[model samples]
Target: MKAGVFYGTNFRIGQSSGGLPIIDNDDIPIALVQGNRDGVANPANAQETYAGIQDPPKAFITIPGANHYGITNEDNLIREPNRPTLEQDVAIETIARWSALFLRGTALKDKGAFDYVFNSGDALDPNVSVESVTKPIPEYTSVVSLLGLGVIGASSLLTNMQKLVKKST
Candidate 1:
């Protein structure tokens, strides 16, 4: 029995390369655990990946109210102390339960573990006041031009540095 866990924010490799690697048919009984509220690796990407897999025993568990960093017990422990601690025990228990049901050929439903996060209700309290929601057209255009110029400047600098190193060598 083999099992694989993939979080919604675990799209670093996926986004860097445009999309995630396709799952081979040989790799069966895979489990993908995603977060519904994830900003980085959106649920759509996970769904796409799940759809690409040709395996039969695949399960996609979308945890509601979880953000990019909220799914991990370590992240929750440090960032949110006031909330109930999402200890390692809970994570291990969830993983074990999922694995036993999915990979062990047990007669469990396709719906994987859907544990409610403790600090889901806590809203972010920013110290600074927010300005206008919309930016001026001219300002936005200027910002884009400045960013383009910065990129060009950085590229020129890198080219010059490489030339200098080559000359020295």
Candidate 2:
């Protein structure tokens, strides 16, 4: 099985002539797993990306009181006082449950299991309310992946041509 995880906020697109485009869309799947308190990939940015996707079977799992690096559960030698212990087990369990349902077509519906990690409001600031969820429009296609390959191919060809021209000179 193939699985991919992306942890970032900004996404940019370029024009066909290799110039950055102004009318770029921040399309993303609804099946994203994110941290509500993520500093790098903020929830607002994730929401913006979600707004641009035109597909279904999507979900955005937001973990509370979690940061970008904190989710991975790396070792902390200094042991800063009052630091909340990383809920590594919860993270692992959430990813596993969702992945099984999404990637493996698991039949068992465990709303409690998924909601525990995603719907909990405890991790967010008291001033923040759960953002209203929306489904992606069902008409959009993701050409970014194919376009990326094309860009790489064209770049390689250009480099080869430049080398040949230099050799002739």
Taking all chains together, each candidate's TM-score versus the true structure is 0.42, 0.42
Measured on C-alpha atoms, candidate 2 has an lDDT of 0.46
Backbone Cα, N, C clashes tallied per candidate:
0, 3
State the lDDT at 28 in candidate 2: 29
lDDT of 1 at 2: 48
TM-score of 1: 0.42
lDDT of 1 by residue, 79-144 (tens): 433332234445434444443544443233323321111111112211111111111247888999
Q: Where in model 2 is the C-alpha error above 4 Å?
A: 1-30, 75-86, 106-169
TM value for model 2: 0.42
